[model samples]
Target: MQHFAQYDGEWQNRAELSCLLDILAISSRMDLRNEITKEIERLTKTLVVFLQNPNVDRNKLEQTIEQLNQLNLTLMSSSGRVDQVLGQVDLLKCLAQRNSIPGGSCDFDLPAYHFWLNKPLAERLQYTQSWTADLTPIKQSISLLLQFIRSSASPNTVIAKSGFYQQSLDSSQPAQLLRVSLERNAAYFAEISGGKHRFSIRFMLPADTERPSQTEQNVHFSLHICQL
Candidate 1:
């Protein structure tokens, strides 16, 4: 079996094989562990409330919560998409069984799963949307979450093991942008010739940041683990 890399530990030590383990060494390169932890905590609480709420529709609640846990942010960027699809199948089966879906089959169809094997992630999302009717909010929310998951590349875009955002670097001579996708194993990294740079770091700023002066390079920007 292929080993998947993941965020592990309190600070998210990045260890391969245990894709879910926190990455320890990268914490110092950028203050990633410090910043993200809070948001993760917040999301955890939100998930708890969402699941525990007495009034929320149970089916919708379960579906949304399932994706939050099922769509592992770190798994994208690798060829382990099978697991994600399997997770979906499992989710669907559980939902079918619970709702007493008329034709639900728990034995699992190997050929049908194989049919889904080659579908592109984006196409898979579209297929899911088309397969379900649009009347209920539970279906709509779960479908939307699926869209979010597919929008993120399963293998992240970032090629390097870690990312850093340093705004103070001289704009004239620039290094490459390091990009990491939350969707998958796709990660991008930067290589610099020589220099210790002091960076003014910001974490998960609102999308409406001031645009760079026209003179600034219209280069791509990525949020490094340290910076975000």
Candidate 2:
């Protein structure tokens, strides 16, 4: 639980970037304005912090900054067009509330949404794609940062006797992420927890709505102590 706290920001941003990319691929334009707005703010803050950090790679930082500047220009030029599209996407709030229900997006539930969906597919695709064009820089930057972080450490095979494992870390070399993977046929999942100086993992069997208990047998898994 504690180790997870360390990379929450990075993971959340990564997830948002991924979701945006997927949504951008579709012809239906759900109101992605809020998501895009939030990600733009997050990326700007991240880029500012990166530029201020002297220890970061200068070459990579320069490339990222250049891309961000171009994206800023795009954003400024398309502000009005983007706003018009956002104004027309008024079903987002209702869609959010009923998303979990089966057949939630039926015509009766959101007639305006159905009307938009009835537009020519090509037009829908064009509008949605254009709306996210200015986000290219942030998408690229997030992808690169995640790749760098994951590649910073190599995976090692570890065994948990009776489904419990613990290890002490060298405080000087702090890990930014902890990855635990097991064989496809394995019957248990790993519950990981740790702090800056140590880490622990408990392998527990799958239990639906019931408390999961640790496995009594030894478990084999791959551990990646990612550092960035």
Candidate 3:
């Protein structure tokens, strides 16, 4: 949705429709609302424990807890799955069915969709907003959860000798996410692979027509092992 908002071109309209269909398909297969509600409840309980610590920021902690509470309530109060409501829209239902076929959404295949895409920007946005309204709670909850998880760990400077690095993970306290940050203009990029017990990173140079090769020189980068 954020990406779809960057332009008002015809291609952007196609992308917006694609995004909506993708979200509906994925959300329909899982009990996303229930899962998010449970996660929020768990996070709120975890945050409440920090309130007793003198070193913690009480104001910020309380605010986050309140936000989680509101999100949880909103999820609980929402009547049905977001996909179920969206599936009722005739255009979207047709789009969903035809989306599996190659070139199935072309102008001749879906004239109504083509016509809708050519609608005025304001009218298109109005319909898009209405279609996405049910998704706001899920989006907000996911964004907040990601914010908390990403900030859970501090970044540490690490060097990959000969463009390779490996580390064993503690099974008792496994990491939820691993983040590697490098300079924007750096010549090489980090390729990371991991499992329950260990992880590895290799810096590789990009190639145009062939497979990328690992850089022989040591690479310095910041790594974050987010456990929360």
TM-scores for every predicted model: 0.19, 0.58, 0.93
lDDT winner: 3
- Give the candidate number with the greatest TM-score: 3
State each candidate's clash count. 43, 0, 0
Ordered list by TM-score, greatest first: 3, 2, 1
Residue-level lDDT tens digits of model 2 in 135-212? 554455445556656876889998899999999998987776888989989999999899988999999998899999
The residue pairs that clash in candidate 3, if any, are none
- Model 1, residue 97: distance off in Å is 55
- Candidate 2's displacement at residue 192, Å, is 1.7
What's model 1's TM-score? 0.19
Give candidate 3's error at residue 75 in angstroms.
Answer: 0.8
Q: What is the C-alpha local distance difference test score of each model?
A: 0.35, 0.63, 0.90
